[model samples]
Target: MKNVIKTIGIWLYILGCLVVGSVFAQDVHFTQYTATPVYVNPAMSGFHGSNYRAGANFRTQWNAVSTGNTYRTFNMFADFALGKPTYYSNYAGIGINFYSDQAGDLNYSTNKVDLNVAYHFILDNKGTNSISAGIQSGFGMRSIDLTNAVFANQGGGFDPLGGETINRERYAMFDVGMGFLWSYSPNKDRSYYLGTAMHHLNQPELSQFTSIGVSDRMYAKFSVIGGMQVPVGERMHLQPSFIVNRQGPSTEINLSTLVSYSFNREPFDKNSIAFGMMYRGPLDAIALLTRVNLETLAIGFSYDVNISSLSSASRSNGGPEISLVYVGKPKNRGSERYCIPF
Candidate 1:
């Protein structure tokens, strides 16, 4: 049987979290970026036309080599928009998000709470064009459970405490991020947006050893996330989206296309179903996504197919993720609904 690789991988995962070894890691990510708009870019804090919105995302990955060891992530967020839909009216957006990420076996976890604020510059009364700027302040904490950790020299023992150390195992930090987004729509039916964000501006030092310069600080991240919506037919529409992330020495890119079939066209809320394929690279994986929308609520699901070098052990199976979004609409405000996410 093969046991060597799994052991090495677990150690690498631990080192990745500590950022003191050759390994380093990035922030948690989900395949359904559409469902986690505010988490992706603070500029999207109040991009939706609704008065308020809320959503959650969950993901579990990498159970191939070891069944008990995997990576899990969860995020929940909500945002509010207050303003009029007029060419001359300006608006302010506010949002809050909380997320937790944990790696199995090591029982390592990171949790963060974030506050997001944005200002939108309405270019026209029709809400055809607008630009937004946003800023984020957050608090983060990380820790590890050595009891579940399989360290060397234990001969794979089942000790309760596993090992002993004097270094601090948990710490917390304050984080800062900001971004800008621009949305443009020639008419009410077609729309697109492009945004860029910078995260980890303070470079939080994530070292379990409690040593400062010895370990590399969390790397600053510059990200580009955008999408477009186009109408190809009366009921069918083409939606393409992408997100590219660069943090420290790592890079991730995901591109997706989903076709939507509308069943009901409500001026304020639309009912539809969408399905599509996504390609994630730098040589990673492909995913299948499906989304359903009913009035003010939408649900999305995605399954990834492992295509990277680790596919052999993963058996080409990546992981599964689910996302939910809800928007609150109060009657009809005396304004035009212009923000459309295709």
Candidate 2:
């Protein structure tokens, strides 16, 4: 009886997602928006403290809702800057991003790959302020497995598999996005930035079925992201960030604050510990985040505590995410005058 109840609840959750998808046509997202910089803004392609950057992220959600019925996502990116290393010189950036998401009992999945480019404009002689514009192009594929789907008319009762034909299992589409950003860094201990991005500008078709009356077009999404870094002391700093996203009829907002303490006085030494909290509004969840930095490598972890109406179904279990990042210069290269840790 417990198993049957869990199965029914899982189906209900899946049904809800499908209904919402059909109406709002929203996209999958990460709570840790800053961890996936390129996904948030193409202008962030190579906007780190180092000349090159690489990172990976993974998230899993709703494990307590039902066994074997959950959502998982994985993402990876790499980016680098072009031209000579000088604070007063302009440069270009290029990057690649890839991600995959799997959801529900049907094992529905989406895979995407994107290429991004950006140009940076130096706004001051000291290079303390700059602007950037970026563009991205991508392709994505969506698929679902229907072999285990249950139908109402199968065997004249509730059947796990029916005789109905499932003609389409996958679909592919192309997508594009653009962004603009402005950054200011007075010194190594303080920085601020704001950016906006628009995605799915083409609204490409997403339906696998070629039949009439099917209008499964991807909806356009817009985002606003901003953050600042403040030095609390010689070995401590504070960071506050926010992100707002809107797609079709749905919207989400996250606000966060973090504090980091460095073990060494040198800003570039990179030995530090950071911890923070975030709130997702409309009462979604409260997230706790922590990270450790070791020279050129950093590792981060976060967990969400659900606090919304869905907590009844989710059992307040929410989700957990992990991320790894690396930033470095070439073997013969030295550090630059301007650095942005994010």
Candidate 3:
């Protein structure tokens, strides 16, 4: 019975791949997508409450299923409020980010660096409401180590050379994306925001094999993200956020909520804690997460519980992720007029 179940799980996975046919690499993804905002939307680049913010995230997935086939991702970013805004003045922000992802027996990897810029237009006095437009320009490299790849001809053994003529071992390309965001903040706190982005607008070619007559271009992706913080009590807030992404034949959606309690009474209290649950697309997994906001520092952790048919082989454990962020505070910077959040 156990073997039958395992075989069914494998078939389900193969069927999924067939149904999604050549969905191309949307693999640079995270269950805790909120932890790396800049990587998702350029408009979030410099949209924060403080003068500047920096953060990093790391993720490892599917370790229980295989010792050498787990997927790993790491990314870091820095965003800066370019100029000080007045009660109703428009301003701009800039940011840069780096991302790396790799997985499988072949050690296939994707790495990218991007520069983002955004211009904000204040919609009301006190910078309480605003809209912004942003652009991202980046360079990307996709590579793979074929040393451990086993082809059907190899009969399930490693082959340093698969008797195939490879066109290129790795390649680099230029990539572009754009985004827009709307924000509403009634008081001195995190703003409610809605944003949309279009990535891989240029559809950079990333194929590493010469099997096809033509190389493959990465599928463009569209994303919608929204978030808000609602005060539920004197010292606690309800933080709810969501993201939707579509690339070629693949689509993913995540909805999450966290309850945050401030240990300090300061307006921008850095001492706080938040815990919550999140759900992934079409019953992929359920995640539990917690975040700690300390003085000038924040850390977050999340665990994913898989529920798909693949869970049989994975023991329902999707994996774990962690994030670290430095939330900067400006001293005597003359009343910050811009928003903060990216």
For all candidates in order, the CA lDDT equals 0.79, 0.79, 0.77
User: Model 1 over residues 1-342: C-alpha lDDT tens digits?
Assistant: 235654564456445555522243478888898789889889889778767899999998887855676888899999988765444477889999999988767667889999999998988766678899999999988877766655453459853321232144677978999999998876656888899999989988776654323454788899998888888887777889999999878899999999888886532236988899999998799999999888888989999998999999889888999999998764366444567562
**Model 3 residue-pair collision total:** 5
Per-residue lDDT of model 2, residues 1-342, tens digit only? 655754564456446545744643577777777788987899888777557889999999888775676889899999988765467777888889999988877777889999999988888888789999999999988888765555433433444421222234677879999999999999978888999999999998765443423356788999999998888998888989999988877788999888989998645338988899999977989999988889888888999999989899999978999998888855343436555556
lDDT of 2: 0.79
Ranking by TM-score: 2, 1, 3
Best by TM-score: 2
**RMSD per model, one decimal:** 4.5, 4.9, 5.8
Give residue 173's lDDT in candidate 3 (0 to 100). 80
Question: What TM-score does structure 2 among the candidates reach?
Answer: 0.89
Every model's TM-score: 0.89, 0.89, 0.88
The TM-score, computed over Cα atoms with residue i paired to residue i, of candidate 3 is 0.88
Off by over 4 Å in 3: 1-24, 155-164, 210-212, 266-269, 331-333, 337-342
Each model's total of backbone clashes: 2, 0, 5
